[model samples]
Target: MNNKSITAFTLLTATLLFSLIAHADIINTNTTGRNTFSHRLSNLYIPEAVGGETWFDDQNQYNKLDIVASGTAAYADITVAGTVVGTTAEGANIYATDNSGIGIAYELNYSTPGATSPQYAYVYPNKLTFNGSGYSLNGYMHLKYALVRLTQFVPAGPITQLPTVTVNYHNLGASGYPDLSVVTLQGISAQPQITACNINAPGSITLPPVNGNSLVEGAQGITDAPQITLTNCPGAINNIIYDFAATYYNTHSYVNGIFTTKQGDGYAKNVYIQLQDATGTGIHINSPLTLPGYTGSGNYAIPNFRIAYFIDSGTLNTVTAGKVETAIDFTVIYN
Candidate 1:
């Protein structure tokens, strides 16, 4: 080969090597052509059934969460805002790709430093339209909240507060091109926490006498003759559900597989208690039942319940009546 041609080839190889070394530092870039991109995140506030906001859901299902942008930008005057919706349709911990089911939509607006009103620039997690360039179905822009299921019961207090969680995007690459900073979800607080009731309160129940005459006369034994109510409930404790866990009871009859026992001395009767909702329908003690969310305004009301007691003539030959008492450990399910 000629000396001039060899020199040109050597120069070309050197230039190519330099270019590769410079570009090696480029990890991720939000900037494309003349336009640049950025992002901001918001906290998800899950309010309790009583009142105020909360960050935890004991039932593993959250429906009252809302998201909003922090409106604070690190580079220039950028405004980000939008709504995000979460659904159980695609199962938990999964964000939807399309705008169809449930997801939040956020918009980022880029402008001069301290600009008051800027034009909307990008629609995140949905459609990104810029400089005659449009892109859809981008999963990188979606937001997600991973709720760890609570195994144990929360302690009873005036309010139960959870620790705050910080969410970071990604670190900035070599160029120091500001990465989509980090956002934090402030702690959540549940109001009017659950507590034990007084001994003579409405939550306690005492049944009337059940004898052979009553059992022979009626087929369903007895209905909730005297309605039971949960009194001293604040307006915050709007809706509630009850679950009973009983260990020992007479085997004469079964109320949804739950037996009733006659504790203490003095002519204890072999009977059982029948628990029911206000509608007189038997509720299973194992499975949980969710009542309607609170819809009332101002102060909430005391929740009312129903139950009936009957002598299990089907199991025992004779029914002895004296002190028909039993104990049941109940769990209060708050939405």
Candidate 2:
């Protein structure tokens, strides 16, 4: 009876050891019991356009952290939790932060022998597989981040804390595997100041009267030079762009900066208003013009811009003497 009891005890011990081993296929050996990834954007220049486009930092690839899981071959489903601000064209997720008009995108790369190169995917929700034999459940897993321009970011001042995103790795319904591992994705810190500029434009511009007989076909009659000033512009802005639009009417004549005057009994006939530079060069309406070397806080006057009246080449002999008036609007763009 004693010999039989010894054999049974040995068999029971072996079964328990096997069970323990089977349940310990995956292990979390993170010394700190947590994971974090951070990125810094110093003096980041945001794009001025607001058309649902994304911009990544130059050092996005290097902005990463290592996450390690030790033990045996398994798979983990990765997910994230945060305020989703927007999405990329390729369907990647963009998370919001404390700063307005800025967002962050997360990416993950799995390093396995089966992969000829690093397999990368946006960390919205993805699965990572550990299929290599003798590979460390302890080996490092790399996670990267990038700064995406969700919209035109015009910060009020220096940027401080953005926010954090919670990333989770779970092995649900998988027998003997760890349930979950959490990683916190930190927001980018930056010091970029974007200032708002005001356009000081003339409400109306009036030209001097001209003799009707002196106005020949295609000849300019009267002219006025108006200055459009930009005020409260900050030095942080590299340059400024501006364009003009006709507010009164839409006609093919706008291509030559010509507009029809207000219709009335005394309104000018066979004569139209034109806009031109001081050098008499015709100004293309709705075309963007960049202000060169515009960097500072001061008043900037639009150079060489003027308006004039010209005889309608279409009606050469029927020029009438009357009022010639029109309105124009201008828009300023900067970053």
Candidate 3:
């Protein structure tokens, strides 16, 4: 089903409802120097369906160590039903794995105690489509179907590199769901490039229905379709560097021209407008990056906005204009 159908995470819901598996990517997150990739979210996002189980507890077995333990790797895994019917499959091998020491208890919210988490209790998101109910055969399956979410986390140090992720949301229908898979990203340009009317308008971004060389397997909606926005490093040659963030939609508006970044995290990248305004301009920094701006307009001009990220020098540079609107989006890529 589509991401919207994936449902919200309520308490320990996704964990108890579906068949589960937990495992870590054999690959570990890369850590170098200077903290370039630190503070960025992983491209991979756990489905609400997979939230809340005891599969990923830091204390259960994963060694109370954070996902970024022993370096900077965020680790977790899933267990699939692997059959037409689920929950009570006879002789079904529980194919999930976690970090070498972690038990099924280390989870997305295991670390943040006393704080609200996306996972908790038994409330499920409205996004998922459950074609069939999973029940343990003779009460055995329900006991083992418990699982947990795989969350990407930063433990203590800064990150230098981000693990590349390719997420595919599968299936749009209510039943007979689609599956998710990673695919090689492609397409320099795509069809559906819509135009605009005003200077603030971003025109349109062309995105294929599915990302990479292969199609999505079980889920659907914006998950399958991925857009690639390249914010080239300005003036930096030889060692190529750029900032990247993956999201569901191609071009997203802030609903009210309002966006917020955490204060201490040091994350305030530019909103790289792909198709600059009709006047060949794009917005960055928002001038008063922390202040409010006009997002509403009676005019037909659609102010283009996306959760875009642009590269910074890693260390803060002397700023005359504060952290607000650095320049039009293109400035980050073009000299």
Summing lDDT over every window of 10 consecutive residues in candidate 3, give the lowest-scoring window: 135-144
Candidate 2 per-residue lDDT over residues 1-335, each given as its tens digit: 55554444444444444433322224342331364655555434443454343344424322222233334444544556567888766566777755555565665555443421225555466456543333333343445545555544333333455546444444334435455565555655444435457777778877877876667766365466667778756433456788777787553375677666676798877677787877777778888888765744456778867777777666867777778777777888764
Per-model TM values vs. the true structure: 0.37, 0.45, 0.14
**Residue pairs in clash, model 2:** 69-137, 70-137, 70-138, 71-137, 98-162
Q: List the residue pairs that clash in candidate 1.
A: 83-104, 83-105, 84-104, 85-103, 85-104, 235-300
Candidate 2 lDDT at 285 equals 83
lDDT tens digits, residues 1-335, model 3? 65565667767645457765432111111211111111111222222232323331111211121121111112122222222111112222222222111011111222233221232322211011111122111110001122223332211111222122122223332313224333211111111111121223233333223222332222112111123232211110112112222132222223222223222234233322232222333333223221122111112212333422222233223211112221223211111
lDDT score for residue 186 of model 3: 16
Question: lDDT score, residue 167, model 1?
Answer: 23
Worst 10 residues of 2 by lDDT: 58-67
Best by the TM-score measure: 2
Would you list the rank order by lDDT, best first?
2, 1, 3
On a 0 to 100 scale, what is the lDDT of residue 162 in model 3? 19
Q: What are the RMSDs of all candidates, in order?
A: 17.3, 13.8, 30.8
Model 3 ranges with Cα > 4 A deviation: 1-54, 57-275, 278-335
